[model samples]
Target: MKIHQLQALVASAETGSIRAAARSLGISQAAVTRSLRELEAAEQLPLLIRAPEGISFTEYGKTLLTHARLVLNQLEHAQNDLARFRGRAEGRLSVGVTPWITLTFLAETVLLFRKRMPDIQLELFESLMAVAQPLLRAGDMDFVIGQLHPSTATQEFSCEPVLNYETAVMVRRGHPRQHCRSVHELLDQDWALNFAPDGQDALIEYLFTRHGAQIEASRIVRAQSLGTLQMLVERADMCTWCPTVLQTAPLFQGQLVALALNEKFDSRQLSIVTRRNSTLGGAARCFIECLLQVIRKHARSARKEDLALFDTLTLLV
Candidate 1:
């Protein structure tokens, strides 16, 4: 009912215990216990199961926690908006970005954003759309600029395409199959892919459909992080289909090489993804504008450095 009551519940859930929640909230343990009891009494349902180890949410508590997070985040956004209108640029902005953006324009965007809103707390997470979706839905992250998964439903979010995501099969520099020109020639080798749960089948289909080569799932390794996929490709014969931007990052400078297959994979887009119908706060809006400015600036340049690194980038902006 009350805002503080909701905050108490959320803090308890996040911190995992009553005493920890009380400490985070700058309140006494007894007050935290009282708020939890009051919330439970108001809802006429048990919200938390307190134990010596920690506090665990009941199913009811789990459901309410989601809404509680949304409510709290929205309230913070309202406060931030008011502060911005009063010429006070101070608020927290949480955003998720894929690896390519970091290698390309994120540094420029951050510098631009910080100059305008120096007091705003910026939190950046290196995440794929699959990893960032739940946080966006729960209002834990303000937005994400990453590749959108075609197989995943996005009716709950708004995705605005910014750049076309080009990909290629990559392997270690001296791997035996590195010179293979056809997908069929590499089917027998191990494959490591970094993709969403539903995106694996689609990527696999794209990689092999041209050659009509069917790959067994047993030969494929599902990678959760870019580091893991990089390790697999660099240390072993495992090959990966990833953003062509990897070829430009210093981390992969000489260790990895893209296979020049005659076939091309399906096109994906890098988009600015945010919750549907949600108004972005001041810090979030300013950061997105900075990101777009960098993208547009680079897209218009004909410098040799830009051409070599961003040749495959086709901007939708």
Candidate 2:
């Protein structure tokens, strides 16, 4: 019946304890308890069971929590819409991005956004799509810039493809196997990868099986951070499958090179996802535009690089 009651319920469900929820909401524990009790009385169901280990949701409580999340998200979206109508670009804009998408290009985009909307607060989350999805559904994030996967919840969000993300095998410049021509030749070398539920792992498995190469489990490094993976490949005799867009990074300019592998790699699409039919605020609209502009600029630079390489190959011919 009331906003505070729903907030208390959702916060407690998320934090696992009324005390923690109260602290997070910046209110007294008694106030949170009162609001939660009020919500339970209105709904006529026991939502949370309190115990020595803290509190947990009952089956009925879980159902309520789902609807509570939707209600909260709708409220925030309405607030955003109202603010936009009032001709105000003043609000917190939270965006989630995959780690691979965070680079100098993203940094520049954020910086330029700040210059244009000094009144808005920009919050950035570098997390996987699996992690970012729930937060977006809960209205904690304005939108997400990440890859679209087969497992992605298509019914809950609207997605627009931003660019095609192509990957390549990268190693430190002048590695011993740099001159190797086949995936089979590099099976003995150590490997690093960013693990996700997406196609990367399946593709890797298929590549090894198809080439009759067996990679030792001990030699395979599962890296969650892109920076860590980059350093691992740069400092050791290691190789990683990486996004070709990483070529724009100065840290990798002269230190890493994409191997001329005989096998082809799969390309995936990156997209911007927002809640379906949710109208965006001016700030959120501007942020998406900035991301598109950065991608266009990077595409232009990549095209020029490809042209130069083509000229060099022509000279050889």
Q: By TM-score, who's the top model here?
A: 1
lDDT of 2 by residue, 117-169 (tens): 77787899987665687788766787898765545546778887776666778
The deviation in Å at residue 58 for candidate 2 is 3.9
Write down the TM-score for model 2.
Answer: 0.79
Worst 10 residues of 2 by lDDT: 308-317
lDDT of each candidate versus the true structure: 0.85, 0.75
Give candidate 2 misplaced runs (Cα > 4 Å): 13-16, 23-31, 41-46, 59-67, 99-101, 128-139, 151-157, 197-203, 210-212, 275-279, 297-317
Error of 1 at 19 (Å): 2.0
RMSD of each: 2.2, 5.1
Q: Which stretches of candidate 1 lie over 4 Å from their true place?
A: 151-153, 197-203, 209-211
For every model shown, what is its TM-score relative to the native structure?
0.91, 0.79
Please give, for residues 1-317, the per-residue lDDT of candidate 1 as tens digits.
Answer: 88989999999988999999999999999998998899999999999998899999999999999889988998999999899899998889999998778877999999999999999999998876667888888989999998766434357778888888678888888899878898888888999886666767876777786569899888899877777878888876798888887787767867778889988786678888887788888888899999999988987789875776676678888
